[model samples]
Target: MYKILKKQKWSDTIYSNWIEAPFVAKAAQPGQFIILITNQKGERIPLTIADSNAKEGWVQIVYQVVGASTLELSLMNEGDSLYAFVGPLGIPSEVENFGGKVLIIGGGIGIAPIHPIAKKLKELGNYVVSIIGARTKDLIIMEDKMREASNELHIATDDGTYGQKGFVTNIMDDILKKESEAIKDIWAIGPPIMMKMCTRVANEHNKQIWVSLNSIMVDGTGMCGACRVSVGGKTKFACVDGPEFRGNLVNFDEMMLRQKQYCDQEREALMLLEEKIRRQASNG
Candidate 1:
């Protein structure tokens, strides 16, 4: 069992965790993920490797408590142990000196994974500009960390509660108008819809954009075939081939459809867990 070193609530539904995972921490790189199981009977879920400290023997993961497994995880605290932790999985982000400006776009909890990528790009001598957004102020996350990792940061919210009133796309459009030729590469990680929109914007400018797919993954290894995605007219498993791919070449509609495959079952499971929680509360 892997021990949880620390845990903190980042927002009403989001939580940050630090786990004592020496092996994974040592091998982890920006953009890779970990597959974790909460308990013996819990379903395996893949979480991005937000950050890691090899010497300290810890890896950071930030997730939204949206489902049964995550809700149960939210109730656990420091010193708690996890049933299984397997990772540093998937391919690492392709980091290199692009010799020009780099744009990193993140939406909602997606900001967590972008943090490490932005940090690494900056270290490789690229001028990193980060554009992040959420539905409102309450959901905007990882602002401080993104700021430290990037040379400049722009924020957007649908409600106008903070930063620009529109979406991150608005900011990206403005920047592209002035700096399109200067931008060497773009990396965006977010909800599927958000990534699709970002890909559209990049395509308009003829800019190459790399997107991380939140495809439904059953096994971290390639054997399951559950995380397959179509890119450039070929089937590629997000588990092995990528969670990241060239945005313009990916079929977002199909990927989005695949993501919703378990929604009904997920809702049922969540309802059952909620009822169980209520029963325990009443008994207590």
Candidate 2:
């Protein structure tokens, strides 16, 4: 059992947890993820390695309460334990000092994964520009952390309650229009629609873009084709092959459809969990 060393509620539906998983922590890299099961009967869920301390034997995972497993996981506290913790799986983000500036774009909870990648790029002596966005100011997280890793940090929100009154793509558009020639590469992690739109903008500017796909994954290995996605007209698995791929080559529409494949079941499961919680609260 991996102990939950610490927990912090980031927003109304999002939380961060530091888990004591020595082996996984030791092997973790910027873009890899872990498959966790709350209990023996729980469903497997994949969460990105937001941050890690190999020597300290812990990995920080930032997750939003979107499904049954995540809701149950969020109810867990610092002293709780997870039934199974398997990872540092998937390919690590390619870290290289690409001649000029690197733009890291993250939307909502996607900011977590970009944290480590931004840090790595900075270490490689690349000029990092991080753009993080959420629906509102209350949803923004890890501001100081991202600032420390990036040379410049920009923030955006759908409702102007925070940094800028727009999406991360809007900021990207502005940057591209001004400094397109100096941008070496762009890395983005977010909802499929957002990433797809970002890809369109980047492609228009002829920028190289990399995106991470958080598709529905079962097993964190290639054997489970649940996370298969089409890239450049070919099939690829997000678990083993990548959670990262060239954004311009990805078929975002198809990916978006696959993501909604179990929405009905997911909604039912979440409703059941919430009802159970309400009943338990009343009984207590």
Candidate 3:
């Protein structure tokens, strides 16, 4: 069992956890992920290794409580032990000096995994521009860290609650217009729709683009076949082959539809839980 060394609530439903997994931490690399099981009967969930201190034997993971399992995970506190923790899975992000300005784009909770990539890119002597956005200001996370890793940081909100009044792509367009020649590559992580938009923008400017995909991953290893995604007209597993892929060749629409297959059931579960809580409160 791996212990939860610490936990911090980042936003209303987002959390940062420091887990004690010395072996996993020592082997972790940027862009890799871990599969964790909260309890004996719980389903395994894959989460990116946001940061790690190998020497300290701790791995940090940031997650949003978006589903039943994630919500249960949020209820865990410091000193709690996880049933199973296995990892450092998935291919690491390709890090090198590509000799041109790079733009890193992340939307909502996707910023959690993009942080390490942006940090490594800047360290390699490339000018990194970061763009992050959410529905509103309160939902935006890791702003300070992203800013420190970037030469320029642009923020946006769907509701105009902070920074620019539109999507991150709006600011991206403005930046591309002025620095199109200087930008050599773009890396984006987010909801499928957001990634699709970023890929489209990059394609318009003929810039090389990379995207990290989060599909249904049952096991961190490729054997499960749960995280398979279509890329370049071929089958690729997101767990082993990549959480990262060339954005231009990915089939975002198909992935998006696949992700939504259980949306209605998920919504019903949440509603039922809320009703149960209400009944308990009323009885009290």
lDDT of each: 0.93, 0.94, 0.89
RMSD of each: 0.8, 0.8, 1.9
Write the candidate numbers in order of decreasing lDDT.
2, 1, 3
Q: Candidate 1's residue-wise lDDT over 78-193, tens digit each? A: 99999999999899999899998999999999999999999999999999999999999989888999999999999999999999999888899899999999999999999999
- Please list all clashing residue pairs in model 1, or write none if there are none: none
Give the top-scoring candidate (lDDT): 2
Model 3 TM-score, 2 decimals: 0.94
Clashes of each: 0, 0, 0
RMSD of 1: 0.8
- Give a tens-digit lDDT track for model 2, residues 57-166: 99999999988889999998899999999999999999999877999998999999989999999999999999999999989989999999999999999999999999
Report the candidate with higher TM-score, 1 versus 3: 1
Question: Per-residue lDDT tens digits of candidate 3, residues 36-97?
Answer: 99998788888988888899999999999887778778989999999999989999999889
lDDT of 2 at 259: 94
Worst-scoring 10-residue span by lDDT in model 1: 212-221
Q: What lDDT is reached at residue 219 by model 2?
A: 93
Listed in order, each prediction's TM-score against the native is 0.99, 0.98, 0.94
